[model samples]
Target chain A: MSQPQPTVLILEDNPGDFFLVKEFLKRTSLPAYEIHHTERVADAIKLLQEQEFHLILMDLFLPDSEGIQTFMKIYPLAKQAPVIVLTGLVDEEVTLGTLQQGAQDYLIKGEYDEKLLEKTIRYSVERKHNQELIMRSEEVSRKKLEALVQERTRELEEAIKKEKLLVDLKNQFVAIASHEFRTPLSTIRFAAEYLHDYLEKIDEAEIRSKLKKIEKQVTHMTALLEDVIMAGRTDLKKILVVKSKIELRNLVDKIIEDVQNSTRNTHQIELNYNVNSKEIDTDEKLFRNIFINLLTNAIKYSPGKESVLLNIKEETGLLIITVTDQGIGISEEDQVKLFEAFQRGTNAASIAGTGLGLSIVKKAVELLKGSIRLQSGLNEGTTVEVRLPVATTENKPA
Target chain B: MTTRILLIEDTEDLGENIRDVLRMEGFNVVWARNGKIGLDTYHEITPDLIVTDIIMPLMNGLEVVREVRAFEKQTGVSPIPIIILSAKATPEDHAEGLAAGANIYLKKPCSIDNLMNAVRSLIAN
Candidate 1:
């Protein structure tokens, strides 16, 4: 029976040494043979790519490439094949060097007889197969690790984006808070200084106005702080709409009175309430939020303008309130993001505003199952209309 | 004659306070609540010196400095002294304010006396 022959590629420059190696291999247990021989390392590379060899018998020195360079050149191209380096030099140092750099074993020529050669060839073939197995497994594990790293990177990027967005929102909040607080605090400081520095000479009317300014500023500061807190709570879904029986007429009147008293300007706000229901089941805090936002917006926008018309009426079971301002109205573009948090109209940009008023108003309206609309043109005027379904006995703002 | 100064601040009460204090100090001060309005008031009053906050809507302090510099260049007038009053106390902000043609950059919550001194020094120069 013919033994299963392992095909070998021998890279050697010397013809005598090549023939001797070939004869030695023929006497081995690998009897039937297909031995490919190349004198040049480059030629051996081309042959290795074209054909699959079980093992390689290579001379470290060649005409085209020499020593470590020769082996390095063909080593990668000779994929999955175990190399047995045959050296005529017979020096232990050089042979060991090639073996260390991935040649499976080295044979010193004329010294290795048939049995030793046979044993070495068998060992080289077996060792190469095992080495290939280890390499293949390592390759698979490396691929898995790479894919895992890529996936983790993607997840981390998404997390970072979300974190950056939260940071940006927080930064915007801080900046707004600083600007918002500065107003009332400065008002109190200035008013107090006025009272302190000029108390004796100042008349009762002047002292009263200064005190009123301080009072108004305190109210404004409290409201601002409350709004900021409410907004934060609302974002966290912590603030729930609390519904109770509220005197709608009195609430409207009270807001009107406060707004009028607080406004430092001489501008008037004409409130016309034609609601039939005096009492309604609604959230008072939410109601106040919507009313104050609209009312303040009206007053603030119309700085030097005459009167703002605030009209509340019941039509088709829906209570509708519209606050009309003759101030510098918003442009078409600016109105698009007007209800977005921290967004202000282009014309209102220079004006002292937290840009939270409209946003809060929109949120409050949504909670009450109501809708708010804005109508404005550049240089014309602004009108904010809010329509809420009158909450009766069982109905509640959720 | 009182030194006319344009006080540009976004905060209304702050602007009012500064105006009152400046008035008490016997300076003719015209207050504007933003860079754009401040520039407009500058055109109106042609004040001897300008005191402006850094961050404001419409036009910021940097924009104001750039625009005012362009105006000065066009008119062939002695450059108006600009003092930046900002909450940004960082060295970078200070350098940027000066590079934008401001003569002085003062951090906010400044003592009224220090602000007056800065105003006086810049106006004198």
Candidate 2:
């Protein structure tokens, strides 16, 4: 088989030594090779920069450079090529030093024959090629390890953030729960104690009023518990969206009636229904809770306002219900976190509330594939608009 | 002269119950619905003792205490004994209430006996 001509650069200052090395290379029984000759290190470096060679045969003592320094200058420019040191004397220490500093092999003058020189050149080229292969693979593995470490660090940071959010939510829940429960409990305790200590002094009418206050407190506590349980159910994804055909107007009327009865009908709620089709396929229980919460909130927040407006209409394929109150409105800061559990408006702090009403309403609306919007300013008024897509004929239960 | 007490609380039922109990104890009790009104009533009546709830609209109990302290400092009158009744039961909350110049901090739902004792002791002192 024929072999490609191997290019060689010979850097030697002495003309006689260069001729003898060239003669030895020509005598070797190998394939034809190309040789480049330069006397000074500067000219050799220029040639090394311009052209790539298969092997570099360098003399230790050049006109511009001497000893190990000569190899150091040329070694960087050698690139992938193997460098063989050619020395006049057989100094064991100097030869070992050059070898340690990445010199492929060292040849002595008047000692090595053509055969030894040929073998040395072949072995050095092969060893250098193998070393380059090992280095390239090591580089690839190092990059891969770095990328994997960065990805793991990102995932750990995300997990820590989620853990911190859960802890914050837990703390907020504890504070709200403790505060809400204690107020009513205190009232019950005070009323019971007052009656027990002053039973004879207080008449039957006063006794009945004290007992009634206890009952009212117990009812308030029960309602608070129910709100907590409902919130938990929604959080745990336990509430299922069961869509069925129902009269939307009737459902809303029933809800309004219940709210008015509970609130003692203090405020007049004017309902305006403007829809041709009253039937809608939706989760009845979720729908009831959503409007119940909205209507109750409208009445509760509008303390002195005599009336609230509930407008229901259909736009495109969506059913839009808006409950507007002409009472103390929510501030921009409070409105931002209005849907978050246990968040209450700063102005509404004095009002009695579990602060779970709006969050629960939001979750219920989300489950029904709807959206809610609120518009209000501090002390102006609040209007809550909920848009829910009416299920088409295909989605209707058979 | 009656041992007059100024009671500050937001909840109607709870406020009424406390007022009735204090009235039954023979102390002339004046109830204010919030911290702002409570502070105003404190100046008007100059009651023997002040019992205030911590969380209320217009102003919080701490602010009222600070304002009352500042007023007393300026007027050179003897500071009225103050007690804080609140649902905030955390150690940090207690520290804050006392630090705000309240004579005593009582968590909500405290026994009526405990409350009467505290009120009597502060008034007596």
Candidate 3:
């Protein structure tokens, strides 16, 4: 079977030149081609708009356009079609200028043979096709690079914003630490000073009360320091979950006992245990930290209230504990940032606190692969629920 | 008559200690737990001197000092001596306290002896 014909557009005004180019194309060893002829540049543009062509033979000096301008006019309309200029020997200089302006090749009117014409058209089309492919690939790669740069810029902006937030948090922590420590230190100093100055004049009961105040202040300071250290450890991701077998009921009872004694039995702590198995495998240290912080917070916030409650139960493969209090509860706005380090409720300003308790509890719960939820309202009360998977041999930390 | 002083503080233990020490020194002391209550007591009793904490609920020490000064200005009463006790110990904090009309700015954990001396001298003036 024969190859399909190549379509050609001839934009030469001279009939003699157009006939010569057509005859040369036929006589060449090229495949048969369809020819579309036009005498003026405008007519040639209209023909190009209507149909595509494999090649174009243009004359630099047409009736409506001339020289390099004629080639420029047709060049944009040529699209991917290769364009070769036809010129007389006298217009050699102008023809070379058309070549520079993207006319593929130029043939002198009578000096060129059919073989030369065939070779020129073949090479021009091939070269133009290769140039277009290179341009298209370059465009694709340039767009890909632009998208990559945009993505990197967005990532860099996010990192900068995070860095600024961390710096702000550090400054806030310093300010809070100074104030929290000073309040207790002031109390301790005054109590000690009073005891020294009035040792001989004060009664035994007064002496005991002053000493108790000093001890209490010292304990308060120690707890604050421990919270700061624990927060630092968790922020650094240095804590490891160490699972061990523990009696859950006894452990919780002991924590409640400790909290009650420390508060001097200021509030009653009722514990309700409904779990079937008292024995469980878990990280004892993390569990203790979680409950201690929760219970202490519940009692501390609920001044003048009678009691707080601790409830524990078990679901399939899950252990759930809830601590409820009838305290001055948290507002909705405060609860949003309650678990952030060094954040305190607006109502808590009158109450003494480092605002680190719930944050510490959150980190401990996360380490245990557990989830904590808080329900609270202004003056209504607060209930914190924690759920954890019961650690078995298969799911235990490696 | 015993010299009367108003002590404004929020921390329970510290406030109690200050009140006790002042009483031991033979000055009649009235304690208020926050700035609002302190201001109300200031109006009711018109104590001979005022001691206030900087950070508190309802109002702050600076606002208290400004209000007292404004009251003195309005009523043509003699300006009352005011001492500011604060945990913020920076030079800027001291300037801010004094600028707010406090006669003295003392950092927290200040020596009890120094506080007494300041109280005695300000009363004498």
Best by lDDT: 2
Candidate 1 residue-wise lDDT, A162-202, digit = tens = 78866776887887877667556656776787678767876
For every candidate, the chain B TM-score is: 0.94, 0.97, 0.98
Can you write out model 2's per-residue Cα lDDT over B46-83, one digit (the tens) per residue?
98998999876567788899999999999999998999
Question: Which digits, one per residue and each the tens of the lDDT, describe model 3 over residues A1-398?
Answer: 96667899998888888888899999998888899999999999899899889899988788999878988899988989999988888988888888788888888888898999999999998999998999999999999999999999999999899788778677877888878888889888889999998789899999999999999899988978888877655343456677888998888889989889876586899988889886888888888989988998898788768899999899998899999998889999999999988889888765657788898999888877789999999888899999988764433343
lDDT of candidate 2 over A238-287, digit per residue (tens): 55568899898888888999999877687899999998677998888889
Residue ranges of candidate 1 with Cα displaced over 4 Å? A1-165, A185-219, A235-247, A270-273, A302-307, A326-338, A346-348, A375-382, A393-398, B1-12, B23-47, B52-77, B84-101
Which candidate order results from sorting by TM-score in descending order? 3, 2, 1
TM-score of each: 0.56, 0.70, 0.78
Model 2 regions more than 4 Å off: A1-8, A14-35, A40-54, A60-70, A84-133, A191-247, A261-266, A275-285, A346-349, A352-357, A392-398, B1-85, B88-106, B118-125
lDDT score, candidate 3, position A365 = 82
How accurate locally is residue A313 in candidate 1, as Cα lDDT from 0 to 100?
Answer: 98
Residues forming the 10-long window of minimal summed lDDT in candidate 3 chain A:
A389-398
- Identify the superior model by DockQ, candidate 1 or candidate 3: 3
Each model's total of backbone clashes: 0, 0, 0
Return whichever of 1 and 2 wins on lDDT. 2
- The sequence of per-residue lDDT tens digits that candidate 3 reaches over residues B1-125 is 88899999977888998888898889999998878889999999999999998876556778889999999999999998999988877799899999999999998888789789989989899
Chain A (alone) TM-scores for all candidate structures? 0.59, 0.74, 0.85
DockQ (0 to 1) for model 2: 0.42
